[model samples]
Structures are given as C-alpha cells and as structure tokens.
Target: MQPDSSTGLNGKGQDLKIVSLISIGQHPASGRARRAEQDGRAVELGMTLAASSSTQNLTVLHAGDSQQAALRSYAGMGLESVRVLQLRESADAVKTLSEYLHKHAPDIILTGVRAESGESSGMMPYLLGESLGWPVVSRIADIVSIKEGVAEILQALPRGQRRALTVRLPFIASVDNAAPEPRQSAFGPANRAFMEQQQCHSEPDTARNGWSIVSARKRPKRLKIVKAKTAADRFKAATAKPQGAGGKIMKNQPAAEQAQAIFDLLLEEGVLR
Candidate 1:
C-alpha cells in the first residue's frame, strides 16, 4: 500500500495507511503478551485513524512471520483486513520486516513495545523509523486525533500520568498495554482470512553481517518464572514476602538521643564504620 497523496497542511494526503506488526510464531512467555498488546494497540489506533479520515479510507497491513498462531490472533482483532508478508525465519527477521514496511510506506505504523523472542528487542519500531526517516513514538496509549498531516498521541509514562505528543505523518509508534483492549474476531472473518492467503514477494537480503552464536550448557536465569491462574493469585505471590521488618521506633526522644539510638542500632547491626 502506498501513502495517500492528498497532502494536508501537515503534508499527509488523503487515504492514509496504518500498518501493524505481528509475531511469526510462539514466543516463550511475555513475548506473546507484548506482541498481542502491540497488535491490539495498532488496531485501536487504526480505528481512531479510520474515524478521523474524511474519506474514511485506510489500509491495514500485517507484517507477518511463520507463527500461524500469532497471525491468527492478530487476524481475529476484527479491525481492517490484514496483508501478510512472509519472511524466512532464519534470515535477519528485523531487516526483512523493515524492508516490507519501507515498500508500503504507511503513514502511521504501530508495533508492540517488544517482541516475545530473541533479545526481546523493543528496537524494531525505532530502528525501522530511523531507517525510513520517520519519527517514532514509543509507549503510546492513545491517538487523540489526526488532522492536517499530524497525529496527536497520548503516552503513558513510568508513573500513572500520561503525556501528550503531536508527531508528523509517516511516523512509527510502539503501542503499550495502556492502549485499548484488542477486539475479538468473529469466526467467519477469521476463517475467511485463512482461506484468502496474502502473497509476499522476496526482496534482496539486507540483513546485517558479523554475528556469532555461542552455545552453552546452561544459561543464567534473568527472572524467576511463576505460573498463576488469576491476577489476584499473581499479586499474592509477588507480595508474599517481607524484608528487614524489625526496627526500633524511638518516639518522644530528644534529638541527640534519637541520633545516638540510631547510631547504636546501626553499630549493633554491623552497618556502621
């Protein structure tokens, strides 16, 4: 899909295209979750883009991988139709995906904060945007509005607060869980999508060079894995333990006395010089 040509003041012409990233296959843990949220956010943003367009014209493309499960999940989002681009699993996945995206040149591209596999790299959107000479907005929660070739975006920060940003057209934004929940697909549409397979054309491999893979008998664990049936159960497990609880509360003591008491306690605990 090509970018629409009806240039507004912000230079985004009519008939803008929105592209979403999809995982090729099953990832170990949070990988799927991250990708799912990203896809959902993409659809949510697309819906917003669709609403704001006077022509009501938009195209949704799915940069697909071999992961049938991930593809189906994305297909079921009940948004616009998906255009799938198949890339070799062993090839430089990022480069291949970027190349397809560049060919399409969608006005606004939406991706997940991170993928669920290899390096868990959250770098695709940024790297792709840099390669395409487009701006990138990470951790987007909402698309407030689009007009005159610019998009107003809402982003969730480390705290509970959200910040608003306005980016020019042809930009990339990585969606986070802060975006709307992904819609479920009706069985009919999903089945139809499977029947109507989208064809992908291979481009010259621009994959990077100089890479090494070292096999190891064991890899160090980055985080402890725990399985829980419910959100409450997960919360319970996380907050189950308390640390360093015992402390003297010297209330109603003189200022100097309190300082001495703290010093004595520190010395007793072998925490002082």
Candidate 2:
C-alpha cells in the first residue's frame, strides 16, 4: 500500500498524530475557571489539520488537575474524550508534557500563545520545542498544506499580514486568534465525553519558591513636545490661557480651506510634519 504523500499519511494511512495542548483559563472579570480562548483555537486548528486526512488521529491533552470542570468545555467541541496528564498546580508541566511528546512522537503539536491564569508567560512552546529539539512556529494563522514530510504554514504577522513558512513534520506551533474560530462545544458531549486521566511524574517548580509578586509600578508619562520657537512662547504654551475664542475659528469657509486651516494648525502644533 502506498502512503498519501499529499496528505502526509503513513503506509497504514493512520500515521499522522495531532495533539492540542489545553490549559485551564480564568475569566478576566470574575477570575473564574473557563475554557481558554486560545487553547480552544488550538484544538480547532488540530481538528482542521486532521480533517485533511481520513485516518489521522487527533487528541486534546491537558496537563493539570483532571477534576477541573473546565476540561469538559474542550470535550464539548465534538471530541469523544480529553486526555489529562494529572499534575498538581505547582508542578512544572513542561517536563511532563515534553516527556509525553517524546514518548508518543506526534507529528504536530498545537498550543495557545499564552495561558489565562498563573504566570501565563507564553513560554511553553519554546520550552517544549527546546527540550524536544523541534522547530517552534509562533502565532500561526493556519496550516496550508502538508506534503510528504513538510507542512506549509501561514504565520500571522502584524498589520493583517501573513507569511508563508514550510516546516517539517514533528513541529510545534502556537495558534493565533487570526486562525479560524472554534466550534461551539455542545452540552451533551461535554457531559458524556470521558476524561481519560493518567498519572505523570510531577516536577516541582523550584524557581517560584519564596517568590514575591507585587503590583507593577506605573510607567512614567510621555514627554510632551513644545512647538514654540521662543522660550516665552513655550512658557505661555505650558501655562493656562484664557478660554473662549482664543484661536481663530473657521466657521464659514470652503471645505478645502477649512481642512487646510486645520492641517496648518496641526502642523504648527508639531502634530504633523
């Protein structure tokens, strides 16, 4: 039997394995547990990639407490089950997750740019990629196509731009909001979907020992530019001036002239060059 090179399937047509890493999210307003926004998108992307190959396998994996009710939200996204690597809150998930990936050797790993709770440093993909020695693509909009052993990806760029990148199989990518939206999870599946739990080696985070977290100091205000040519003008500019009809007003004039007057005033104020 020949493998599908276009879809990048193995000889058995079931070799491609995709995994979406999910984390418990906290609502900003209430600080309550909920399905993470980006993690949902990660699962969406993983499902999208799997849709290309008929026999491809997709798994939603979480490395946290399995008892959290938020895990069901991911299962609601038309998934039969969610695999949870049971770990404590203080346990560093990178080591355990990296070990799992090493053992399974999935073709692709999808994750969110940042978590909604805890430190949320947005460093999981980098750390996991470093540990696994795989290429990590950050803020990817979509995976265009997978051929042979390479997958073409559309990387999300600033200012609504996308850059095409081709990465080999067994790579990690951080899903961006620019990607397709995730489907709404149904209540039935969420309640029925089984939570497959597995005990994993928990590595305590020693770096956070005795860590002091304080509210960050506010940034200094931006310096203002004075448009006055003379020091006296600058002083007058800084000082409060008498209100009511101080500057020339263009009430009755052509639209172009009024626009030009406004433009000139803005230019004089150093607002435009």
Candidate 3:
C-alpha cells in the first residue's frame, strides 16, 4: 500500500496517513476482569500513536463482533469510531484481517506484540507483513519521524538498551511494553463512540484445531543478584549463566554403597554442605 502524499498532511502541518489500529479484547475467562482494565496493550499503543500530531486520520478495526462489550471499553479510551468485520468463532482470522486491510489499504498498521487470548501465537505482525508484503518493525518504543517514505523509530531492546532504526512507510509495527502506558478510557467519550459493522465470509481452517491446548501456569521466579559494580561487571553478569546443581548417580550399587553415594552426591551438589 502506497502513502498518498496529497492526503498525508494535517492542518497541524504534520505529514498524515491512514493509521489503522487493530485491537482485540481479552476473552472474559482470561483473568482480565479482575483488573477492571481491558487486556489490549497493543490497542493502547495504537491509540497513543493515533492521538499524535503525526497521523491525520485514524481508524480502529476489529475482526470480531462490533458490539462486544470489550470493544466499547476501547471506544471509551479515545477512539471516535471503530469498524468491525464480523468474524465467526472458528473463522480464519488472519485471512479475514488481511482481506479488510487490502480493501482499505492503510499506510501504517499497528498491533500488539501478542493477543491476550486464544493461541496468542504473537505472529500476527509477521503474518500481516507477509500477506501485505510490507516491512515490519517489532518492539517499537517510539516513532521519531516520518519523512518521504522512511520512518525513524526507537526500538526497545533487552537490558534497558534502545536502538534507533529506519524503515520504509506502509509497514507494520509491534509495540513494546517499554512504551509509555496508555491513559484510562473516559466513560463519556466511550458512550459517544460509534461502531460500524461489515459482513465478511470466512471459514475456519480446521487444521488449527489440531493444535493442543495447554493449561496456563505461573513461571518460577529466577534468583538474580546485582553482582555488577562496573561496566565490565555488568556485562559479565548479563552474559553469565547461573550454575546448575551438581550431583552424581550410582546405578545398581549395593545398599551400603548406595547410601554412601547418595550422601556424597548431596555434598557435591551443596545440598548438605
């Protein structure tokens, strides 16, 4: 999709483009209701960009039911209107999303790193990029500037590092958590927002059903020590892997010997030391 230069400028003298902010609500069962906040970090990121002076026009899009309560929650956040392409529960979401994007041909598309429900494959940006043949910028913290066809952006990296990059226009970007948090949705604006719905034919790809569902669980916390005092120390601390427990096993040993071996292994592993 090419960005039309004529339609690119806003009254504020900033270059403009049709920025599509794709949003998905977290499934009610996804443990988000307890927080009383919608589970769409990507939507917030897109909202932030849409509110900026850089974008002349912004359109919010969703593939599911337009009337979903969670969608209204997004409207309350700041969007004036949201367009929905009704999608069945089992429909091929990627295909449907691509079709709508093709028809609208937005110059810039923004999405979250991953969805809060379903497979949460975190591959939407990649898939959309592939389908639209557009360059994708991941973990974007900020868009510094967009002149002509190139955009300068700041990327968030591990260890609190930031990287600057430039990419051509008509691209997809995945927002990083490092970006500023979004403002809370106001009840008044949310009530005034309009929702536009469109019908689309999309069938489920049964092949996706073959995938296994795993129970969600909390990850064990890793023990970290601030052993670094200087730049070199910090580098070493960042690169070094924690040592694993050390032990020895005895196979087919006599009872007496096995007991002794077990005691020795405990000491070797520092369990008894």
> Please, what are the lDDT tens digits per residue for candidate 1 over residues 176-238?
888887777566665555422455554443443344533223445445466999999988878
TM-score-superior candidate, 1 or 2: 2
TM-score against native, each model: 0.63, 0.76, 0.71
How does candidate 1 score on lDDT? 0.65
TM-score of 3: 0.71
- After superposition, the stretches of candidate 1 with alpha carbons farther than 4 Å from their true spots are 1-13, 24-35, 54-59, 64-67, 194-273
Tens digit of lDDT per residue, candidate 3, span 1-273? 566443222234444544444555454565552112223455665555555545436777778766567677777777788788898767778898887788877767877777766677779889988998999999888777666667778899976789999887788888787776666778889889988888999989698878886745766765577766799998888888765455456788899999988887779756696
lDDT of 2 by residue, 122-238 (tens): 999999999999999999999887878788999999778999999887789999999898899899999999999999989898897667755334567556576999989989878
Q: What are the C-alpha RMSDs, in order, of all predicted structures? A: 12.4, 13.7, 12.3
- Each model's lDDT comes to 0.65, 0.86, 0.70
> If both were scored by lDDT, which would come out higher, candidate 1 or candidate 3?
3
For this target, which candidate reaches the highest lDDT against the unseen true structure?
Answer: 2
RMSD in Å for candidate 2, one decimal?
13.7
Best by TM-score: 2
